[model samples]
Target: MQNVFSEENIKIISQIDNWQKAVEIACQPLLEEKKITQKYVTNIIKSVKKYGPYMVLTDYFALMHAKPGEGVNQLAMSLLVVKEPIDLEGKKVKIFLILACPDSKSHIKTLKEVAGVLMDQCNFELILKGTKSQIIDLFQKKEMDGGKK
Candidate 1:
């Protein structure tokens, strides 16, 4: 099977210790693939760097619901969702960071659905805490599960 996580991509991913780095690295491959332009990537990176990831998600939902900004909002909305990290494990792991918010309750059902989708596609895990070692362990365990299956 082709390795979905290329060395360059891994380098970029590893460098993502903050939201700015995450935006830049996450959008780099897309820019290279011509899936998005440099200007768009810059905009996204700036937005994340300024307001953070949760703000981006909030903007996305606002645009989706209100169709604000003559569709620029909608475009931003789609970009945020599409920019979610690809499943390099060949499986889906819907890791949600729980926060104190009223809407957080709604996310549980959707996150569960995402986990189910991931597992159906391949052996996967749903993590709440975003620890690197724990994420690695999930993939390692999935590999063992695959062997058994």
Candidate 2:
């Protein structure tokens, strides 16, 4: 499989002022790469407002996304690791995964791959504290290991 993440697609930040800011920052890499439009970012915030932190998939983690064509240019993913946890509604989140897919079907495999990797508690903790390269390496290793630990 191709690499789902690149150096340009990841970021490590110490903190964010709020969940909204966190979302924006998390989407920055994809935004800069033209994988998604500003409208995509706005749509995500709007969705969260309407749905109430539904993207916070689990404690300390979030997978922020909007429907395909809200402004997507391609299928891509971005990562933002906040060294200091930020609040999303009542939940605290440290990792944000911003996904932009041109169509509904394209993201399914990548989503499963990511979820499979993070499903391991050990992988989740390492990713939460990992450097950009470390995170990329972990993901690649997991993929090579057939998504095993």
The candidate maximizing lDDT is: 2
Local accuracy of candidate 1 as per-residue lDDT tens digits, 17-59: 3343434454455445443455554564454445534332311
- For model 2, residues 1-149, the per-residue Cα lDDT tens digits are 25888888888999889989988988888888898999999999999989888899998999999889779999988889999999898889999999888987988887898898889898899889878999989988877877656
**Number of the top candidate by TM-score?**
2
Give the worst 10-residue stretch by lDDT in candidate 2.
140-149
lDDT of 1 at 109: 43
* Candidates' C-alpha lDDT: 0.31, 0.88
How many clashes does the backbone of model 1 have?
Answer: 0
TM-score of 1: 0.32
Q: How does candidate 2 score on lDDT?
A: 0.88
Regions of candidate 2 where Cα sits further than 4 Å from its true position: 146-149
